[model samples]
Target chain A: MAWVTPVTNRNATARMTYLDMNRISGNISYLYNYAKDHGYDVQGDDVSQTTWTQNDIISYDFWYSMTGVLGEVREAAGLDKSVNYPATNYYSVNSLERYTLYTWMEITEPPEYGLLQNREGIQLQTESGADIEAGIL
Target chain B: MPTISEANKMQIRQPMDIMVTLQVGGDVSLTYSGYSDAKVADGRLDEPNKKMMPLTDLQGDGYPLNGSCKLYRPGYHPTSEEKWGERSNIGEPCSITITASESIGYVSAWVSGCESVTFSGNDYPVVNGTANIYVEDTTATFTFNPLYEDRRIEVSLLASGAYFIFNNDQIISCVVSLRSDLSLINPTLPESEIELQIYQDEDISERLASIPDETLITYSAGYSDEMSPIRNFYLSEKITWADNVMTIHAVDAVHKLDIQLPTASLLTDGSSDTGEATEESLLVFIRACLLYAGISIGIMPDYEDGASNSSLVFNRISLREAIAKATAWGRFGDYPTTWINYVDAGIPKLESDYSSAGWHIYEEDCGDVKRDAARKIKEIRMPVSALSFGDGGNYLTTNVGTGTWIYGSGAFLDFDDDVFAWSVITEQNAGIASVKSDETDYAGACERNALNFLAIKGLMEEGLPMGSMNTFYTQVMPWNSLQLATWNRYIGSSVREDQNLIIIGSKVLKDTHIQSFSTGEDDGEIITLDEAPIEGKLIVQHLNESAQTLYPNIAAQSILNMSNVTGSFKWKGDPRMQPRDSAYLHRVNGVTELITIENITITHEGGGTSAEITYRKGKC
Candidate 1:
């Protein structure tokens, strides 16, 4: 199972939490830019968000919507917005399927080195609840 | 589109008696609709003194809708009272202002019985026979001088020698326009439009009925020996027989690809093509598409899609849109159709332009660079939208998002589902690609990567971008894709340090799975379009080609963002000078510019050929 379950945290109050979500927000600078480029009049109040944003898609709907939008980008066949082109296994492409496997081992209580809101440093906790300051870049 | 040798060019340029053999399916007859009906028998419709032949229109624009199309040779000199053909050029003619109440169409003094001789104009001294009149709603006096540059001036009549001969039937005249402005990034060259007027003795309409749609019209131009490379094929679309002339209109092979193909069974997702051992390629897919389209293969690119037995993917769209979306890249050149010659003489068997088959990417990344002495001759892929191949689009970070809260267009476990629980495609919100280890349901969504792009962006062509002040016209190339040309067979990449994808115009529009499409009209049922706004299904059905769907799939509306082609020129005519042909255009200053042919307009009449070439400077 993925570390952050979408159903469980679709509307998380915190911003820029997950590494991949923030990274994908940075990976794609096209969402709002493409909307402007294609004359796709923005339907919501937030039309100004046109650059790199780690401000979260926030729900399964927006994430899948972005995926569907990717299908709109011209390419070979992999941009599957529908099942018509499904081998039914292409979703495992890259690390997508890998994340779906191996349950995320969560600890019931915070450990001695758990992260805190007041200060910012680095907290590395392994599956066995140990802490380390590896400083991994 | 073939490359003619310098010698062939010189031979074509040399003034010679170009033998013209033009024939339709059978005999045809055409009657000129001008002048007095009284003089129809003799073919002379002018006054005894000014016997000028009526002017014919070459292009289809500004065809006199009022049926009063009257034009006499302005060749007749009024000041010197010189006869027609005496002057080498057409100088301005004299005209006078007329009242708004006067009838429009020109009344020629040359015609057998036409005359509105109220008062003579300044130029004509002999007698008032020609009147270029203009009328308006109010009593405004209008000076009606013919705009020499209008569509009317572009036409020229085919002399008796240039007429098409087919037994008892005869072709009066024919005009053809090939390719278009270079900026237009269609997958392949567009269809050449042809219009012919035939004079018939009997009702050959019965025989002509068999050659309307689907029949390939094999048209060969230039000398008999050199005509092999100049032949073009067209599918007959419409034929109209009226006033003894058979008018036929046809298009190129792109039209033949409209039929639906079993894409699900042919083009799989290619899961095995992922990982290190796998990548992207368009070869097999292209062949498969052509087979389903029933189009014959003439030229195939060099790239190959990875292991053919990859996991199947699911996607449904129109065949035309599929071909337009899929692109390939390679080093390609045009040649004669001799490899796939006509079954019999003057008949082509679906050899629609072969160059279109290799319309995969050609010199995509190498942007607008002037002549690179190092790379002597390179290909010019149609300039697509900048967002296409390179420049990573909305890809999931790390190909799999860091599991978190998520929101997408489709429904899932909740309006706000956990990122790990995020999934969609139609109803279930489950199958992303497939179910994997520890996952209760499938969840691969959009981790997609684009190696190429659909060159469906519209092009705004300007003869001289530096000179034209008006807004350039945006023309959609309509057919090409990411198959931009490259020395290597990989899609251009700017984000990824390692270049991995390879495509050669695959069986892009294939069906790897053999599932039948439901024909039920449940897509929509519009009882009436009277008051209701247009529904999605109605729009899709009426659009016919599904071109309205995501298939025109161009990510951005790229208009004149990048332009390699600059200007154009005119030459007597070269059958070998097709659209997209790489050739040299010699300027008056003795400097020869290597140019890519963008648009070609050819007129063959009176055993003579003339071509108007729209070209761009050849570059990276």
Candidate 2:
């Protein structure tokens, strides 16, 4: 009977999965512990066993250290550089989007971030000491 | 035999192409082209690289699909080669030779391509230049000029396809060489002959097919764009081929008649009587002789009415010789005289007066000298006496003893003053009455001989200019009987002089018309003109008519000769000038006289055209 539905009658629902930060920190600690036990040097500034939270460890120094360890880990896993899915996924989603974000951030807040935030619903936070002791950092 | 219509058709339809086939041992090479293919083709024809394209789908009659066949140059292994585009290494040089065939048509090349040319000794320079060699009767040989070891060059001879196009309309050139012993006086003799040479590759068969047997051929001084002005000849033999050359031998029509027709005695069935002894005109006699030989008369002289008549008795001579004898007697005291001349169609024509056509001769310094200059003058030797009579004691006179009697009449210049007189008396017993009758017949025969001698003497006394006028540069003469006669008499005699030279004056004693003689026989004597009448015959005196007509004619002609400036002059190739045609000479001394061309020789070659004309001074 009506040509178009009224805006008041329209309703929609969306679902999203968030990143498990605790798991991520735990995985990083395990990697660091494995490297120390195997007598591999953690050759990077400010990258040690104490820096387990995502914020402290999300630096160029930590990333450089992780790249060295990741290469060894990849060898231990019998994986080739070209078929390294973790490295490939990290560069594809993070490095490309980071360059884009940096370019727009120099001028103004990127509207593209709104679309990303809405699509992924990701939230970044600093972990408390209690959370770190609970092994959820 | 082909009909005239068929011959005429063939004449118009000339062969368009010439085909040449060469066979060396087992190797066969066939070449064909249009008559003008080599001429119109691009580049030099003598180059080894030039391919003579054979013709295909030829259109014309008498051209075989394979072409008129002829043997290639035989024996001498000449080779040639042909290439299209420039290839870096054209392989070894191949020796190619080109020569002109005696046949008037077609040029041939021996090609041995893609072969190494080997010399006898030294390595010769490779022939690399393209040359447009002109084909003429001149002999030329193109060789490496170096001695070769093998003399045979290995060549890649490119095959010109089987069929080539040829333009048959090219002018047919030929060289006609006459036998060395040919004489104009007795042209019918076997020794007088002609040989024609033409290119063997030419479709001579087609040309010959167009020409029927006994075909008349007219020769000129040079290549004739117009009609020829020369005497005509009849083909008397079949064409012959040898060494890739064709030859044609021809003879005069009169000669052919002499060979074909039987003797005069045979024509008359061995009868002594030629015909009714009624005085017959010369024209009538000539007509009768030609009619007897189944020949029709064409052009003839127009003698004056009531001209001299002759009662000649033809013996065992050929028809032509008999006709000659008759003409000799008939021409006595007749103006211009008559002779049997043949036309281009092989038809015999009797000509009387001079021809109307005349040749124009200019001075040497005239503009376009080649077109007008008379090249040279040939003085034909004139006979000392026109007629001479010798009586060999074959007939006996009743009053005189048997002895040789001599008499002659043609005395014009001082050179002919000696009397050629002789008497031919028959042997008989002394004082025999029957001898008188035979004497009358003998006298009649003598009179006839005298008349013949006088006629021929008169004509020859004028001096016939028999030398050839090389009118090689221009064709200006027409075929006619007019001649040029030059006189070397005194200046005062240059004017017409009427000399009353008696042609014939004789008297014989016989019985008077009113009187009668009795024979001592059983029966009386019969009267007849054949024999001195036994009773009524009278001593008759006869005088020739030269005083009335012949003297004046001779005087007029003599004056004409004196005025004539006859000398041999070369003329530019003019096909129109023919024997007997009139020539008007413009002397440098301002003396102009109308003369006639007696003979002409036309020579046409690549260099130029010229005619050798023998002319005399006379109008008619």
Candidate 3:
């Protein structure tokens, strides 16, 4: 203020706001389309901006994609994709999508259960209903 | 190490080529090449089912039908990358439709349909105003309705295919089952029969493109060596298939005779007297009997000069049994008896020679022939524990023509004793009441019995062991130095080594009654008792006749004592080692002991060959 120069900050601020809004809208549309295609029920009010912030929408998309990618990677590696997710965290994807991705990966490349075995570790269920573990040796 | 040719001689010859032919009926004959395995057994006794040929597939004209309707079950290919995730049920229900053809009978075509089917043919009548259709899962049944009255058609289901019998004799694709309980008593037959098991589609239908039981089966085996030449092993009997297994029953030639001739048919006519016949005459009679029964004669020894006067009356006994009885009589009648049916030669013949002419076993280390390392003998077993004297500690006596013959010192002869002591007595009016008038017959009978008793006693007095030696040799024949060792070790080690060593095949000569004279006056007939009558007195009128009879008895005893070398030598088998053939054995102790091959058994297992030879030490 003491040595103020005539500079227009409003344009920069408007540009940033427009970019933020566009990013939020794009993330919402992507999530909406994904849910509709995959037969998932869409919840919350899409018309109001107060219910979901631009940051919140971006965060949701980030987490959803992270978990979806994790399921796909596990399936491709011939492993079970049904990982224990955090209960408190909110995700945009439904359980059906997660399970479908897991099944697809399982059928594509079956896992070698012997490699994951352990003598004293977490107990896992086998197809024959027997309890087993990884890294046995 | 032996040379290649020497080693080959010692080793068993391999059967290179095998051919199999199957004859279903008279007209429907099917020959198939390549068999899973084949075995032909040639024996010295009667054997049923001689050849076994198992064909993996059935291939012929118009077999397994053309238009198939779910005839085969779906197959899986786990390694196929393209069809990994796909499922296929292509040949399920195992359905096929066969139409009647010139080779294929009408009954066979209808019976081939395992599932429900509709039948429309010239010989069969249609039902329900159209072709007879047997609905799936329905109680409605359509009988095989043939149009012709005289041509009755019969259909039977077999393990791999269907069987049709028409016009009583004509068979269409027929495969019969073998009797489960078959009798095997003939020793000349093969020890085991041929058994073949084939699965439905994997083994039979797919490979040859035919039904399971619709093919004929036959087999032949041959060797390059002249000893065992090419020969066919065939049987005219029907093939047996059960539970997807086809078995061919092949019996020996003797067994074939047993099946063709009934027990009653072997009875002699009893017209010709065996007693009055010369040695040649008796041989002719025996030859005639064998020829009538379709058997061949191989070797026949000369008859005993003394026993030729003894007459034999055959009633209802079999010819084989009669021949056996005739060969055991006379002075030189202790010959070994054998019957050989050469499967390869297709000849069955009798062998009775016990001479040492062509029998000899050379030692491997002697370097006379090639010595094979594989045939290195490891063990030799000579067991003498079973040797025993016949009728020890018993007095033997017989009377003829007013003279009584007695032997024995009223005590058992000690093993160390050299001389046998005996006493003679004269008895009056102790004549054989039944044959009192026939003094020659009475004298002959008494002389024969007395000789048998003395021979047995003299042979057993020294306690010379009667044992068997089972040796292992690399070669098929027993011509080895180890055989010589067996002979010298046993013979030279004993004090009574002067005893003549007699070699007979597996056949052992026992004491036989040539002629019997009855003393009980029972219509002047001969007495047939299991045991000799010991509680009777014999009567005769002249001592000269008695002396003549006793002379023959003494001669006979000497002959029997010379033939006391009994036992068998078992080793690797060779077809050339026939019974009664003589072989020389070079002993380990620098002695060449002549031996005879008594019995031979050749066995082939897992490409390893061996022979078991039963031989007697010494020449006959």
Candidate 4:
């Protein structure tokens, strides 16, 4: 199933089964700390929660976690850390630092079958056609 | 034995401490040790990473976070087991009190900081992680004693007599290993690499962004003046960080080399400077590759034997491949010798008879260091039947050394008089097997040429038949001594073990025309490789001039008694273990046979650091 692009500053759900939400919070806090230490003015919420879950979608702000934080902070601070870093887009887009940090995210539309890995409809059948059952699962 | 302060070399080993440092320059580096303290609170049952200040869980059990060292995977039971996470310093401002309203309403407080509580009127003191108290009066106030101070950042209050645990699990892990190539006889540059895993910290997250390439990393273990050598593993720009973990992978000089040859030649064309114009010496070619890789030569002797001094040709290829081609040929005498190159301890070396294989410790040869149950060695044996001195009788002997040596005039029925070669086959080899001499082109009698050939191919085995080691190659190689020894394990006679000797693969041998003649004087006294030249420009006594050194069994009887090279032994990792080094292993019958290390892998995880050494037996 494809990733769902998180909605901006709104109710957004996440897959927290394998994902450690505290780590995500730590990651966001680290990003904010890194930008601040590198002499950049950035603003963010207190991600000090001990634990988090995908079910807690109320005011979760997944958008602020992904592309909105640094992407917006860099724009406000008049710094383009795109391909150049330390020198405003100095490092290459394919550089090591770009790969280490979560630089970008793309959420494609979910597959027609939805986000369930083991899609229930993988074995196709005509359930709407009530005349006869021809398919063997 | 391991070089330690004798304290660390006890029969039972201690839990070793590890130090992984990335050295960009001299003293400037980054070091990480395992965390020693943790924080415990109330909400950590469902939220493991929940934050709490003054993390002073002095008696909390430490189930060390995963990704810790494999050797230290079990729970962290420090020597002072009960007081595992306590700091040396302890202080509290004053006692605390809690007030309750109802008589049967017992209040349970799940405090993040200290949980030990004591009533003002009660005589006894209490200590623990959680506290619950009961009072019979309608309203009651309880007093708590002083608590020790640790790195208590913050703590939030929750309802219950519950306790949650959280380790300040700062360090994820680090791993280091040396990867080697498994090509025998050929000159291949094997790569050595090391990897480090650093868990992210909220304050110092910026360090991950500035990691540079080509930094040197050294890993050392053991608590003594002496340490194991896990050095020369270089760091590349390949790094990754996700889920608060950062990793860096590095390699040796061999792996990072990307030089293309025909490197700026002296001769130039009008359009461009090309390597096609002039053929350069092999020494020049070797230097170009090693120099470009930022690797110094092993400082060994530069050879000028046979065509080694002769100019050679090569197109645009990797500098490493060119080096292999340059070292395969160069006739020293009757036997053709070969040369090979490899990276040794960060230096590019042209090594063939690795002398360092003598002292490099793959296993505990001295038997001083204690070993664990995980240590084991497997025996590999590939045997042969017999060793025919020159040959048996026929030329079509399908085995490795079965063909008979022939030296009578016109004894060779198929080959031309000019194209002299051993009737050798590709038994256990892949090279074009060659031999060469300037005398092959000397304008003389067919018999005169044959004498020079005998001088080169050496005397045929009749009364005392000794075969000089001929290790020639086309594009590949790998061999052992060409001398015969008295180790008849099977049929009970002296035999020449498998050198897989490729003795006839040179320009003077392989590239010849097959001419034929009848036995009725049709060939006209062509040649004989056994006798000295009777007439043309030759002497009988001159044959033994450079011939004695080839057969080292004369005085000391230093015959390089060879055997099958398939035998290899494995041991656990030790920092001192180095590959390509040779040492003695007690094989049998009190015979401490010299073994050459072909591979070495030292792992610094799980229980303690161990080194696995794979060695080739008795080929020297």
Best-matching candidate per DockQ: 4
Q: List ranges where model 3 is wrong by over 4 Å.
A: A1-137, B1-251, B256-277, B296-312, B331-346, B350-359, B363-572
Docking class of 2: incorrect
Question: Ten consecutive residues with minimal summed lDDT in candidate 2 chain B?
Answer: B466-475
DockQ of all candidate complexes = 0.00, 0.00, 0.00, 0.01
* lDDT tens digits, residue span B325-386, model 3: 33333323321232111221223334334443454454543222221121111221111122
- Docking quality (DockQ) of candidate 1: 0.00
Ranking by lDDT: 4, 2, 1, 3
Q: What is the per-candidate TM-score for chain B? A: 0.38, 0.35, 0.33, 0.38
lDDT of 1 by residue, B112-193 (tens): 1222222333332111122322222222221122234221211112111111323212545556677633332333324556
Q: Which candidate is the best by lDDT?
A: 4
Query: Per-residue alpha-carbon lDDT of model 4 for B1-620, expressed as tens digits?
Result: 33443433455555445555443212211111111222221222212123322211212221121221111111333222121121211233123232223342333333333535445466322312334454454443333333444312122321222221111233345445453432222334557666666554433345445546766655655554565554565777655777776676877676545565422221111211111111123445456667776766645543432221111223344655445333322212222232233544433456543444444332343323232221121221111111123332323222222222121111112221222233333234322222323333221112232322443343332121221222111112222111111112221243333323223322121221222211233323332122211110101111222212111111011111222343444433445545555566654345565765556565554445555555556432
Q: What's the lDDT for candidate 1?
A: 0.30
- The superposed Cα distance between candidate 3 and the true structure at residue B535, in angstroms, equals 24
Question: What is the alpha-carbon lDDT of model 3 when measured against the actual structure?
Answer: 0.28
